[model samples]
Target: MLIGEVARRSGVSARMLRHYDSLGLVRPTGRTEAGYREYSREDIRRIFHIESLRSLGLSLREVGQALDNPEFAPSELVDDLVERTRERIAGETELLARLRRIGAVGPADWEDVLRIVALLQALGSESVGQRQRAALSSVEDVPVPVEALVEAALNETDPNVAGALRWALARTGDGGLALLAEGLGSPAAEVRKRAVESIARIPNGAATALLQESLTDPDVPVRRSAALALGARGVADAVPTLVEMVVEGTNDVDAADALTVLARDSALAEQIATRLVACLADGTMESSARRRLTQALAEIPGNTASHALADLSHDDDRAVALTATYIAKLRNAQ
Candidate 1:
């Protein structure tokens, strides 16, 4: 259909439709021989999504800015980048405060590694990747859990578990998920759970259908296995099922989060952390969900999270407070 027909069908205005085109927000699929713009079914879908985000208070510039960089890190955009720079510095300080203690300990520094583990357990605000990278960045570093501990980390629901899983993926070459897959047959239920988590985090094409198979399992926990796997992959194929589960499922925080992580259809760990921050303002979520949301948001890089923070700050909700506090703290820390 042409602009008029698309607008009539999609409920978006023709002027707004053209404006979207100029902003690179949407493009015509074809043109009439007369040179008028034309759209296919997919283009109309894009138009509807543009309208929805704009309805959510995103300005044309903000929406376009969002398109320019789908990661939604506030630090990258001029509007919120300044504030984002600040929060990243503070997170580093927090990371280092924990690191200094680990450094004082001798050889294995096992206790310090445990100290960080304990702190992450206690605070629950730390970034899984940050802590994982800290320990794994250079292993003349700290050796908290032996390499063998990877199996145990997966089964645990604690968000910090991702850190341990990241290490196994880095060290194990091609055998990481293969190792996890074997764990499924082990006698321990935790082993099975952990294997599912690791497989979700470091995906293999052959593993997708395996994870999907888990969705219909009788066990509630196992059912969640497929959800998280699909989420970690950020596979668009799972979006419909995920969003449906989002509206109607429980005992599946990890799965729900995996889907939320796919907001822009990306699975990069850094970008996932950035989206977590913006989601803090989600009016649809409960209070506890919002708190966890803030922690994830706080972990984004200074350069990447700044712009996302600014746009989300304008959000007329409670997250603005949490966002502002993080921004101020990070700036002063920097």
Candidate 2:
């Protein structure tokens, strides 16, 4: 076949075929009387081979090597191609995400788009100061999208930067709560903890509702964080988890303090006292856990708490009895 026929049939353009010939990648096997280049069957087959290799991301030189070198192993080259393809895909995905985030900002013009992009880049900056500054300024001037704020907050490792991000997110209102809620379901324990932590800072009913749902999270830390936040909000739903925290000795002091806050209501005081008394009476509770529970009961002001403390004062464990005696005396003194 002549060059044009070969180009038409193989889908390789004539210019590219000439370039391949110049590079000695695929030379014509013969020539006609007019001295035009003619491709034999083997030459056409080589052209197709070059195109096939190029399709797999091979450079022209690499394609030539692959077609001509008898010792050229494809395994390493194929693996390298796979890695390159993966990297390209990852880069494209990141670009798409950045574009989506810029679009989400609802930029009014090119300047607005650039500003949002700059703010986002700063949020992801390696410098802690830059990240914190971006987070603080996100709610001012041009507002950073809540999605960006939430992403920063969930992945932020520095305490100050994370706090700034959370503050920004809270100011953004419940708009970021949906994304943060998805973070709550992340398989990663750290991500779930971050999600709940960010949610806890959001003082909206929606955030509180999500926290209430997170009370049953499989991760104990997430459950504790959610319980603490809910307890501060005066939600009685956190009562049981608070009681468990007291028994487990995990943040038991803070848990006890939260319970004290919840106990301000007369009805809730009685309910809180009742749960503490029940935990105290459970046989499975070790002596140390019982002691923490006794100390926790000291904060609850009600007949239920006082009576439970009085009963525990005569318990089998001397340490428990002494702690209970001290608490009961304090209650009596009050």
Candidate 3:
């Protein structure tokens, strides 16, 4: 097998494979005539074993020892590995228990619960305990446990835990969306902003309806959150709101972004693109809107993208001319 193939099959990167080779763990048996590394069947077999051991959480040194001593007993290493595994499990179990105590799995609870569980597991209780005490020792700050992070996330009140939950959400993969949904009804605007940011982190399924609601929000932060979440989700529903926001608003980066996302459609992306192109092409828009107009047009697809730029090919605006040129180049490349 080729080195790339070996790396793919083993689920190890080429760089890591080379590192393992330097450590004498697994190496190519020979080189091709052109000096490409070649692997024998035996080398492939060893790689598979090494990968398995690594997945089992064995250290590289331990894996090397096991590889060198074919008769080495994994049983001897089982106890330490088991303890490490238990510590991991304990974090997940603790988080799950906390979630069960949360506001009873509301509209925002999705598969991301697993991510929060894993984050708690990865952060471990002991480190958090130390941090909590240190936080308390320095000032009169009430000691907030990690459980409070979830509790605050579940409640629309308690901005402290809500803020901390934002940090927690940042640590986890994309689980913060659920928390964002949970906070949509929060009485506080700051909470709403952080909630929007959390929702922005994942940008899919859960944020859609809420974002639709946010487009009509009384609060600017909430409205911005709605736009950002809609754009991040890349949903067609955001197109109208984005278009309106793009033409009417100032410093509405999130709104413009949402519109641009819609315009990039191969199939459904066109739902957003055509609206933007129409607005710019007819001169219904002012020069102030030209920058965002060009941006949205550029994100659009081939013949459609070219046609959008063609409207501005003879523009009196220098920025519009430059941006249109960029769009023409991109369309030709495609």
The C-alpha RMSD of each candidate to the native structure, in angstroms, is 31.7, 2.5, 24.0
lDDT of each: 0.58, 0.91, 0.65
Candidate 3, position 100, lDDT: 63
TM-score of each: 0.32, 0.89, 0.46
Top TM-score model: 2
Q: Over the stretch 278-328, how does candidate 1's per-residue lDDT look in tens digits? A: 455456876555544444444334544555555555555566556646764
Once fitted onto the true fold, the runs of candidate 3 whose alpha carbons sit more than 4 angstroms away are 1-147, 150-164, 170-182, 202-204, 248-264, 281-284
Relative to the true structure, candidate 1 reaches a TM of: 0.32
- Give the Cα error of residue 270 in candidate 1, in Å: 29
Better of 2 and 3 by TM-score: 2
Measured by lDDT, the strongest candidate is 2
lDDT by residue (tens digit), candidate 2, 46-97: 8888888999999999998898899999999999999999999999998898
Question: Comparing 1 and 3 by lDDT, which wins?
Answer: 3
Candidate 1, superposed: residue stretches over 4 Å from native? 1-149, 154-162, 232-244, 249-334
Q: Summing lDDT over every window of 10 consecutive residues in candidate 1, give the lowest-scoring window.
A: 139-148
Evaluate model 3: give its lDDT.
0.65
